[model samples]
Target chain A: MRNLYLFFRKHYFIFLFLLLEVVSLIFFFRHNKFQNAVMYDWTSAISGRVNNTYNSIAEYLYLRRTNFILGEENAKLHARMPQAIYLADTQIYIRNDTIMQSEYRFINAKVISNTTNRRNNYMMINKGIMHGIEPHMGIIAGDKIVGQVVSVSRHFSWIMSVLHKEVKISAKFLKNNQLVSVEWHGGDYQIGVVKEIPKHLIVSAGDSIITSGNSEIFPEGILVGTIKQVKEHQDENFNTATICFLTDFNGLGYIEVVLDMFKEEKTNLKASFQEL
Target chain B: MTNLVSRNIVRFFFLILFQVLILNHINLGGYTNPYIYVYFILLLPFATPRWLLLILAFIMGLSIDLFSNTPGLNAAATVLMAFFRPFVIRAVSNIPEEELGIQPSMRILGFKWFLSYATILVLIHNFALFYLEIFRFAEFFQTLLRVILSAVFTLGLILLSELMFYGRSKK
Candidate 1:
């Protein structure tokens, strides 16, 4: 027993080092899978407050640019307003219709903190559980896809940006309706790669890629990027294309969290079907 | 001794804030991220107990990870760097017994000694960090490029900060 104590005393530092390293590695591997919500809430709450304070001070530096973008978006929205549209068929009376109901609700949130340099980048928004933001919901800037919410605190949420390697967005070519997956491969924040394109398809530069609405997260027709180049993959079957993201991730200021109204119902229906 | 402890405490928070708030935003070319926060680990007093050193390094790293939303990458790298720090110091310089408790700095140690020490530790930290971040050998060359570039930038910032302190102390 004394010999064992001496051994421990002599090699305690090594044991401690090993212990810490193992703990950290566990945290690393278990981060995305089965995230400890309480720990995340505690940490994010503190970081959220700090980032919120810092963002409030730094917001002034980009006011002009933000205003310009907002103005452009406002003009586009204004053009689509009923007041701006000329009615050619005045005989047909326009009435409130019960057939169509709102499918997606948009909640405006300011980005508190964002990073693009890392392989797995994340963005923090100034809205969370209290503000109706939840995990697995989509986020967008204007009509461009930004990311999906991964975790939420009381008043803050973390987003796994499209720049993340594991984030594969279901997208389709706007011209042909051909489906493809958009993924970031850990370099160049402004660019992503489109995969699963059959080699026979005629793909060209500048082809627009938009959300396919195959998943519950994003609605259809939201812009993702424009194709920059297409390269033949090692497999003889599919070709991959590089795309330029429309949303400038580095200068993201305001974003909207997409709350699909029927998401729960759809998921529940799918679950019931799978049970059979 | 109390004064030294308090100063280090102040430096610990100051470095974390400076790193997360300012340095993180400077994503030059989307490749070179200067992790000057590792300087805090480098500047700890030489006589700090091995267990305490490891704990402090872990806490510092975890704090940075929390802010950045990277759960464990920084913590692992910083702890490893801290574990290697004593051996690195012994290899780089022959310190007299009386100078055992002094902090490592360019002003106390010559610029050459400080540079090599900082370079090795920063490289080790960045090497572990960037590789573990990508978690693959597929992009080995690209990740290596990022590691070297980031390490150079981090070393430059550490030396500059040390020089700034050196100039103030001289006055």
Candidate 2:
């Protein structure tokens, strides 16, 4: 027994080193598999408070640029307002439109912390569960798709940025409405690759890409990016194209979390079909 | 002794904030991400207990991970760096018995000794961090490029901060 004790005492440092490394590796793999919400919440709570305090002071530095972008967005919104439009036909009556019910609600949030250099990047926003944010909700800045909410705490939420390797955004070309998925392959945050494009389709540079709205998360017609180049893929039947993202991910400050009101109903209906 | 403990406590928070707040935002050309937080592990006093060193390194790396939303990437790398630190110091510097407990810094250890020490450890930390982050050998050359570029930038910041902050102090 004493020999065993002496062995441990002699190589205690090695044991400790191995123990710590194992623990950290476990955390890494487990986090990748299924995020431990309890531990994530605890850490995010502390880091969120610090980032909030820092953002308050640092936000003033970008006041001019933020205001400029806000003004442009405001102008775009103002143009769509009912008050700004003048009907040419006097016989046309404007009544309560029941056919066009609001399906998506937008919750404004401030991005407290963000990154673009990492292979799998994430962003933290000021809004959380308290502010009507939930996992799987899409985030957009102005009209550009940003990312999806992966997890939420009481006062903060984590967003898996579109730059993440595993993130695949369902998008379609505006010209032909051909569906393709967009993905980031770990280089150049400003660009993303459009995959699964049919080889026969006529894809040219400068074609606009927008969300397909096939998914419950993001509504249709959200701007994704503009195509920059088309390259033949390894598969003969498909091709891939590179696109320059419209949203300036690096300069993201103010964003809106999209709350799909009928998401639960839609998912439930689909789940029923899958049971067969 | 109390002074050393308190000083490290202050440095712990300061370096974490500086790293996640300022250094993280500096993505020069999308290739270099200078992580200066490893300076905390690098600057730990030579006589620090082995267990304490590992624990401190873990906490520091985890704190950075929390802020960056990377759960364990930094923590694993920093622990590996801490594990290799004593050997790195032994190989680079021939310290006298009287100064065994002295903190590793440019002011005390001289620039050449500190440079090699910081470089090897920073490279180790960055290499582990970037590789684990990608978690694959598919983009080996690209990841290697990022590792080397980031290591050079991190080393520059470490040496610059050491010269600026500790250069004036005689102790």
Candidate 3:
């Protein structure tokens, strides 16, 4: 007993170092991403303040640029709105009210903090549960899809940005509406991969890609990106290609979340199907 | 004792702010990222208790990690750096063990010694950080190149800061 105590005393420093290292490594190697959970949640209170201050100071510098982008988006929206509408088929009736019939509504929010350099990137936004924000809510910038809300606190939410390695945006070829997925390869923020496209499909370099409505998270026709290059996969039947995003992720300031009213029903139906 | 604690507290916030706000946003050429925050661990007092050093290093790295949203990568890497710090000190500087709180600085360790010390530990820290971040041996050479490049940038920043602040603040 005396010898054991003396030996431990002599090597106490080593033990402490080893203990801390192991704990850190455990968190690193843990299959669950704990750093994005509790510790980060605790910091939301602080970083939200810091990032807000920094962004407000820096916001004035880019007034002209932001105004230009916002003007362009407004012009595009103005041209796209349904200016001519007819009360088609007087006999046909819709159950929901005219204003509330749409399953999704846009919730405007400002990005407080964002990053595009990491293997897996995430963004923080100013909206949260109090603002009707929740996890898995689809986010977009103007007409371009950005990311989805991953976790939400009372006043803040973390967006798993499209540049993140683990994020897979359900997208499709705009030309044919063929279903596909957009995935980040971790090197560049502007480039991502279009997964599960058929080899038979003629995917040219500049072909536009947009979100597929198959995924409950994002609505159909949300502009994802355009193909930059197409390459044949190891399986000759399938094709994978690189896509360049339409929205400049590094320039994110304002974004909107899709508050989908039918998300619960869709998820429940999918779950029921999965049980088979 | 109080002086040392207070000084480190200030340094802690300063380094984190510089790292997240400035160095992180640099994103040179879209590949190499300079991480100067590891300087917190690098400049810790030589005779400081190992347990405290390790915990402090973890907390410091974790703080930066939380802000950057990289999760545990920095915490793991800085912990590893803390584990190797004592040996690195012994191999580089033979300072007496009686000194309780003489923090590392270019003026005390000399420019040449301080440069080597910071370079070696920064290399180790970056190695652990970038590798664990990608977590794949398939891109070994690519990861190695990034590690070296980021280490060089981090070393340059550390040396520049040392030159600017090291001698001016001493009693």
Candidate 4:
């Protein structure tokens, strides 16, 4: 017991220093910004209250700077959007200049409502008669034709999306001009069937289908989809081709509405011919 | 003993008030921030009990840390100073005669002796405090500069206060 006392007295300061240092280190790392914040919550009430008051004062002082910095960051993000001044004309070129047109004017509109699950699903856009939108306008999103405008209101329009059972758009094989009509199978949004392409055309999976422009609703060569599976029947002369829809109908955000001014004249001529 | 306790009690309030209210706000354009609260730890009675010194240092540091919201920084630094005070006093004073209760000041220990003693300890304390605050040695030179400037300012404040409190020439 005397020896233990001697040893402790001799090294008392060193032991105390180390112990207190460890305590300080515990506090240091516990409240460190890089560490998990929940570790060092054991603080005195008086100090905590004092810190709170100090922090409140500091917070009030820097609030204006914080707001300014946040506003600047937000403005930088907003500037990245396609600006009205940059895309000044109806003939707008987006990233990679994939779309450039004078024959067919493109009006960019936001998709307000959309669905891809039902037998005959439809989509609604935030454009209508007020924005020169009309029925039969082809809606395309980044390389693929999405749908056509079936009804128009004063400020909004509904689209008969290609996922609909009755949708039959004029599509042709990109490899060869083997014309086909695309219709949704109602089971999966990804798969759509192409009709009228002959089995003798040597159709296979991975073949790209594009717009034939036979309907004049969409321009020639607008992307339709890629062939996923070739369903051939011995009795039928035509091949039943399943193609993956290039446009993700479920993720549609903004789409371009194609307005062909010459469509009115073509419709008028067809109407007159029918009258005869 | 009574004089020592009462003096320390008065010094405690004054040092904290000076540190938190006045010195903490003085930002000299990112060049210097004089920490005057450390003066209390420096002037502690030289032959004071080891445990008493550490506890006093801890409380002084804790008070400042509470006000600033840096809970451990000042406490750690002050405790470090308390731990080293005896060794530093022994080294500079070179006199083991008064090992009990000699309050360090320019009046007690001549100007030159006190100058060297305070300068070294203050530098070490500031160095520990600043380095712990950043905890990164990658900016070693940058933090070193801040520590040096802050130490010099603190040292100056300590001397100025001493001159005011303890007369120029001790009778």
Candidate of highest TM-score: 1
Q: Quote the lDDT for A123 in model 3.
A: 89
Pick the winner on TM-score between candidates 1 and 2. Answer: 1
Tens-digit lDDT string for candidate 3 (A1-276): 999999999998788777777877776677234433666567777777787788787789878888998898888888765553355665444455765578789999998888877776788899888998888889999889999888777788889899875688878888898988888877778998888888778889999999888888888899998999999887576899999999889889899999888889988998999999
Candidate with best lDDT: 1
For model 1 chain A, the run of ten residues with the poorest summed lDDT: A91-100
Each prediction's whole-model lDDT (CA) = 0.90, 0.88, 0.82, 0.74
**Candidate 1 docking quality: incorrect, acceptable, medium or high:** high
Cα deviation of A84 in candidate 2 (Å)? Answer: 3.7
Candidate 2 error regions (>4 Å): A32-36, A86-98, B94-101, B165-171
Please, what are the lDDT tens digits per residue for candidate 1 over residues A105-184? 99999999999899899999998899888799999999999999998888899999998878999999999899999998
lDDT (10s digit) by residue, model 2, range A200-240: 99899999999999988899999999999999866478999
Model 3 residue B42 CA deviation (Å) reads 1.5
True contacts kept of each: 0.76, 0.67, 0.52, 0.27
lDDT by residue for model 2 over B1-171, one digit each (tens)?
898888889989899889988998889668458998999998888789988999999998888887887777799999999999988888987877467446887877788988999999999999999999889898899889899989998998888888789745445
Write the candidate numbers in order of decreasing DockQ: 1, 2, 3, 4
What is the TM-score ranking, best to worst? 1, 2, 3, 4
What does candidate 4's lDDT look like per residue over A1-276, in tens digits? 999999989999888887777777666565424121222223323433443355456556556755674576568757766662476674444434334335678898866555553335666676767899877789897557999887665566667789764579998999889889998755467888888778678987899999998897898889989999888888987778889988777666668899896788898999999999
Candidate 1's C-alpha runs over 4 A off are A34-36, A89-98, B95-101, B167-171
Between prediction 1 and prediction 4, which has the larger DockQ? 1
lDDT of 3 at A275: 100
